[model samples]
Target: MAKTNLKTATAKQRIFRKAINLLNQIFFTWNNGNEEELVSFLQTIRDKSPNVQFQKLIASSVPFLNAFVQNQNSNLFSRIYRHPFIQGYSLPYEVGNTKLVHSDWLRSVLIRAVCYCSSVEDFNLERIYLELTCLTNGYSLRFVETHVQHFFNFFHLHPMRYSRDQIMYNKFRHNWFNYIKIQHELSDQLQQFDDKGQLIHLNYLYEYGAR
Candidate 1:
């Protein structure tokens, strides 16, 4: 019984070690972009583990997580990617959720679409899809329009859909890195405040019945 248990434990450890090594290789391939190395690594994986499968790039484009990455003329571009199987599905029903929840969800998704889409055309396409999804899920036209406008305003862009300029969008994308840096600085400042006991952390729950 002891020997059997030891063998089972050793097998599990070996599987875990292999999984970690595979993840490291994947990350290295992603960062380095060595096609030949990736091909060889994938072939080895397939030979060693027939059950594991990988989808190869098609037409220099591949879907990764929620975005589609494309290599075009030595330049890399990306946009929001939706699975074909779930293309017909609507977002969470607006009527079933609180207004705050709906607003937050819409804003978050719009932000993601903006960040992921590298071109104006892709962004506009995603925007239209989001609008249709929200509308089909019982969101009011006015509400959708308001939030969409607010998103444009937050990024200091023209609110009109047709007025979206590629130059302006590119400028916004360039400035986004600076915005992230500022956010990191603010986080560090907050951490300093916490360390100095100058900031208070509060956790409170609102009681709807009391309200």
Candidate 2:
């Protein structure tokens, strides 16, 4: 029969399915087979709440928010997830939206693709998907190419369509130290404005009696 499993880390809870003899059994433990009682104890409090609901999935892979997580041999992997209906849909480039909006949107999508995909192959697929989506939404070819190139540069990867070197990709993948270092550097650089100090605040003031 199908079994449900719940893994909790900090504030996030991920639920997946596994096949076992126990029917409708739910495991609330880690890979080490501990913490089942802690989760069960917490469940009592949740049961007292009327607004909360519990859901179970019967698949090895499930989509949780913007990421698709897969359970392989009890190990969890994740990748970017986009709904089919919303594919290729974004604020059209030809619209009156500011250039910053368009650029920020693309950058955010690329960042999510890089951070979410567990494998280089999955990242390449997400890159292609983003390229097509941007093109279909009227983003300029050069605009997309330049931003995508910057994304690779941010990761210190060769700006080719795909990296043939798995070693380079592993620096960002399996190595948490290197991955976090690059992310911290990128965050620091992005926060600065035109070689000045980092932006402190942004305020929007309305004209009094002008509405």
Candidate 3:
């Protein structure tokens, strides 16, 4: 009976390790624009039994998984500390500060939108922009719309209005809005492909900068 218990513990550890590695691969794909392999890997991880504790890993992996999944452009953990929505939503309200309210609405909205960006190619730059705009207090559709306009203007594309800028909305209705501007920006900024149009190093930039 003791041996069986030991084996069970060992199995859980293995699950934990693989889940951690999968999360790392997801992060690398997002930052480095390696979608094909990441999609395949994500599918494999998703196919694992729902009872395997993958969701639990995401919740418990702390600084690592949070950094891996959250705002990759910013230090993910740092944003959690200062973000207005998080500040509005975090627990342990001060006594007599009954004005405080904690709600998961903003986080849920952001996560669902991110999941819509399934591939590196499909991941739109506006998704990040809208997410940042939405995390602030009393964020209006106009606030998100302003960034959408700026994004398009930067690319010399026609700006989208608040109603047409759907990435700010919940995921189900946030379908493509003929917003080719975002796709162009992502393609232009893709790190793996160089100016001369060649595939660059997966890890070279990190090593080169470390020297």
Q: Which candidate's lDDT is highest?
A: 1
Model 3 C-alpha RMSD to native: 17.0
Give the whole-model CA lDDT for all candidates, comma-separated.
0.64, 0.60, 0.36
Candidate 1 lDDT over 64-173, as tens digits, reads 66777776775777888888877564665446436666677777787777677889888888888888877887668887888888777766765435556888777766
Q: Give the better candidate number (1 or 3) by TM-score.
A: 1
Per residue, candidate 3 scores C-alpha lDDT tens digits across 59-160 of: 321443333233444333212213334543333334542222212333343433434443322234435544454544344565445544544454243332
lDDT of candidate 2 at residue 132, scale 0 to 100:
77
- Model 3: pairs clashing at backbone N, Cα or C within 3 Å: none
* Candidate 2 Cα deviation (angstroms), residue 127: 0.7
User: Which candidate number would show the highest TM-score if scored against the true structure?
Assistant: 1
TM-scores of all candidate predictions against the true structure? 0.63, 0.60, 0.21
- The order of the candidates by lDDT, greatest first, is 1, 2, 3
* Superior by TM-score: candidate 2 or candidate 3: 2
Q: Where in model 3 is the C-alpha error above 4 Å?
A: 1-53, 56-85, 89-148, 152-160, 164-211
Candidate 1 collision pairs: none
Residue 69 lDDT, candidate 3, scale 0-100: 35
